[model samples]
Target: MKSLITAPLLLISGFLFLTLAAARPQLNVLMISVDDLRDWTNFLGGYDGEVFTPHMDALAERGISFTNAHCPSPVCNPSRTSVMTGLMPSTTGIYSNSQWLRPNHPEATTLPQFFKDRGFKVVGSGKSFHHTAGNNPPDQWHDYFRFPWADFPWTRSNKLNYPWTEWQPPPPEYPFSKVEYLRGKDERDWGILPRKESKYDDVVIVDYAIDFLESHSGDPFFLSVGTFHPHLPWYIPKRFHDLYADSEIQLPVFPENDLDNIPPIPRKWAEARRDEMQAARDAGEWEEAVRCYLASISFADAQVGRVLEALENSHFAKSTIIVLWSDHGFHLGEKGHWMKSTLWEEATRVPFIIATPGMENSGQSSSRPVNLVSIFPTLVSLLSLESNTDFDGPDLTPLLANPDAEWSHPSLIDFGYGNTAVRNEHWRYIRYNDGTEELYDHQTDPNEWKNLADHPMYQKVKDNLAEYLPESYTENVPGKNAFVFDPENWTFTNKETGRVVHGRQ
Candidate 1:
């Protein structure tokens, strides 16, 4: 009887020890992406004096804010592609919005796909990829939500108000509310998306994300919530719009002769788009447009706050890693351009925040210039998961673990089809495929208002950054030109060569 009791006790004690030894804590990831969000806020304090993003300010207050974070490319598709695949836009050959990523890079491993392979339930909603909504791979998610913006009353009214208008607001067949701020203005006037009290698309995204958390109880999960506002025709709820009135809102300062030192191609491109911009300005639509953009950003922030709240309240809060990023930055009438297709800071610097469990209380900042491509490998290292072979970025786990640690590479930004720009600690170097270049000492010219490329005093600085440019980009690709719009016709393909050959190239 004594031997039997001793044996049972020993067995129980051994089991307990092993359980304690092998047990890994629960881990979850909350990745929130906002479209066209620029890093011109209180965090980096990039703006001359603007104070818009309060929720993002709070986020920066809680975690790490990458002062020099940038997209792989200035355009959406390539930027998002680089972000998801951990490959630079050049390596992936996804340079423009017209270029579809699926057929071209089918073999590429996506950020969420990697997590899914590790037994984590992954769910996505809104616009994570460029048009992933219409042509999403069924296997990408355990489940996904694609809510229609059609039911928005503002979208319905826009069509009626501007019958000849080429740009219509989203469709109005879906369920949402029309939250109005100003008394008598039509939905189009305010440029605000309609919303149902708590059922807005942004709100819905958070709702589903939190719901996933509840259902997955003990299992690890990866939730990616993409907010579509603050993109085009910047629309937001009325309450957000009222946050900035006409007089209170400041217009983007139009730099006098900003194009004076830029190259011919970029300068000419800006000039070509001048007519449409002037039309909007002449009609007093630009400021309203700017106000709408600011409001949309605030709207996106509120949605972000919801997700953060859920994470904090969940049991997995102590173990989860929260990352929020914008697909790429946008130009709100900067460089006489209103979109994201240039190497300018307005078009390249995106909002990046990473909040880890143990590091949650450690709010820090890094001006270390890292690309969005680094996200994949960093997550892999953070989770200590099985390593894979498909990656073109370095794991930034060391940097995040100790941001003050030394790094060898400067972050590269692929702007236009072949234009490349790199941000070092103190300088911004840009090189166009046509052999044109621009260099600016960010310390002296924070706005990049002056070009030091021609200045002989900083020749060494320029040479160092140039050496950092990848040779892959300098080498030519098949059926491609250095400065043409689309080197590879992404929409259509050639039968004989299996390459994109016809349309834009």
Candidate 2:
């Protein structure tokens, strides 16, 4: 009788053990980013012009592709700040590229910080932040490693070379040379190359990411690897450039009369950027720019492939969530915008593909307008994380489960202070604080050939989008904390309340 009782107890205990094992956290995350990568790549449904990114194509094929994902802002700093903190530019108070984000909100909980708080080993490297200057927060990362090939070489400065410039690395098998400089570190003009194989930022960053996986052996970890390429000076070794020729490359589709219908603000912006691109093309340097951009993208793609390959090769493939995205897209002379800071589709829209473990259906696509801000809540839902009310983004896991899930909110894009745009499936709407507005029907005008803001019929649609914008902004007001960073410049304060604005302010 005692033996029987013990056997039943033992069976119950075994069942409980299995239950715990199944319920225990066995998740890992790998978030990768590329700089100035637009939707022009063949993989992300970009037009087949001069570029081919097979690795990215493969990654997109295995993940849930968000065709209309956009950044909070067009510029790098604010956009990245939004992604990192999962907060809008108004709330975060990180309005521009020059402002240092951390000092403004020292107590704020970043995405990495949240994951790190949950006992996950968080590691970051490369251009994950806005400026790529200063040390990372301790709470956000348990370990941080800078990738070697991750940064640009200072020897190939665009400003230094001026008119006729081509950035080239050292010849054959002997990677780019590293030259250390202390004078202009924070200035955007400076670049740096890697020393040895181990020093290559991309190689080093990925190596450490894979190393983190091996070290944990089976534990969960969150690793963020940022690749800085395809940005400016389009610097890469000759081998990558050699892969393409002017004959094989097709120019971007920018019509001569492309600006007929666009709003004045956007038209002017695009025209300026287009001229810069035209100068490069006229100087017989368009192919060089294209080759370098594509090569850098391909190079970054190769690095990404390695990380994904490592996961598949390791035991973590079954439980890892791989998210690859660009902070914002770059322009290869499309829409007249050369390098972001515009509200056009090319500059605002980004490539967002997520390969979640255990998600059976692959190669799924969603037309829903989603913002990078949604990344926080999406991860929380996927990981079955503890509920928290602080996060503003809604869980997008349902979309992953059913690609046709019902999600109908227009994704919002922020420009400079008081400028905002809302993108829906059929229409794009914009409202500037100076009372300027723009509207475009994407179906009729994909290239924004016509601005329908003056049309009387679309008033309802414009009003609808305007309602989505915050009526009265709250939280991170510019002047309150901005002076800490830049004392000379006066930020936009609450005109009415005299106190810092609230609610998207």
Candidate 3:
């Protein structure tokens, strides 16, 4: 009687009825998460239009693919924390990879916790939550396994000197042919691993996840598979590296003056990695980097293939809801930037797909814009859970059911205090702390190479999109004592010298 979502009854007596507390079948959930995966796939046409994401392409073929999906935040920790907690980085004060939602928003119920509370057995491995200590507390997941770097020979061999700051290549694992030129030698090594599939970190995760799937196939379970690849160091097996050729690699079209007309804040943000892009271009390593990134994508794709195969081969395939998404997008020499933390499309626009077991229009795609923060409510709706978890974005079930349905939700990407981007159906509007703005018509400029904020013709468009920016950016919540927020009037201040900073008080 307590399990409203699942219950069973029995009747046998002549004039009486009996009730039995039996476990009723519920839809199984398989959540696949990737790190730093941009649109450089066979479906998204992100990188040189030659990407080989066959596995992801296959998933998209039968799933509802949102073409304009974006991340809540461009960085890792904040983005994942936001998605898991169903809250925005602005609301939680978790705006960077160094910030964890568990400590910042202690009382918030996470996605996994919600599922566990609703009588679903939750199991996860690898990078599901924000890294240092996952965004979800240990008690949330019935079974939580964090795979170690030392568990994989390839990762253990090339250990980070500081691990967090630098990578130190010890002895070669098995003579993997590596890229000749890499800008950040420590963090950008690309090569092939000669060891068996079990020696890779991602493979280990798949193995654990597959076993979990087999064990909990009958019961209602929430299984998560997180893959860390195409992220950095591009260390994949030689076979995957061979899938992409240096000559076929196509660098993003980054005009020398692409940032010339943009506002100073956004321009300065992209310029943060200007030197890295310049070094690659000058040394003719740009294509090599792209090739490495492409190979990493393929490698991650293969992992997807393995997991999906495992799911399909199991008993819970048809009765499962599969949701695959990346924490945020990545930049492969786009706008003179190498990694995320920018509000541009390259850093925010991500690949998102959902496959409900028996949906009518499963394989179609939607151009309507959606953000990662919506995944929580979307799944809650899909699973039909009765929980009142306040979410910043709307449930995407309608978009999934009908790709062409009316969707008015604009995607929000919060990078830091007073820096955010609002992406709608055809326009992207950005407003910085100094009141400067950048507007891009995605219809005309998908690459975002041109800045039309100064154009007099688009004043109304800017005004319409700017209305969706976060009501109040709590503060930049990553580092220590960098920003102090005054909630009275929604303003930030410099704590060091007690000076009112970013935005008007």
Task: Name the top TM-score candidate.
Answer: 3
Residue range 1-505, candidate 2, lDDT tens digits: 0010111111111332233236545677889888878886665666576565787788878888888788888888888877876677766656676565555555566778778888787888776775333224444677776433333443344421111224444333222212122123322221222334344556667777677666665447888888776666455555555666444665567776777655566666676645556556665666556666777777777777887888788877777888888888877777655677888788888888888764555787888888887787677666666533354445567667767778867888887766788998888898876777888888888766677888899899899889888554333434423332211222223344443311110
- Checking candidate 3 for backbone clashes, the offending pairs are 192-238
List runs of model 2 lying over 4 Å from the truth.
Answer: 1-24, 147-199, 260-264, 271-275, 387-389, 474-505
lDDT of each: 0.67, 0.65, 0.73
- Stretches off by above 4 angstroms in model 1 are 1-26, 49-52, 132-135, 151-190, 194-199, 474-505
Local error of candidate 2 at residue 355 (angstroms): 1.2
Cα deviation of 147, candidate 1, in Å? 4.3
**Prediction 2 TM-score vs. true:** 0.80
Q: By lDDT, who's the top model here?
A: 3
Measured against the true structure, the TM-scores of the candidates, in listed sequence, are: 0.81, 0.80, 0.84
Candidate 2 lDDT at 268 equals 65
Q: How much is 381 displaced in model 1, in angstroms?
A: 0.6
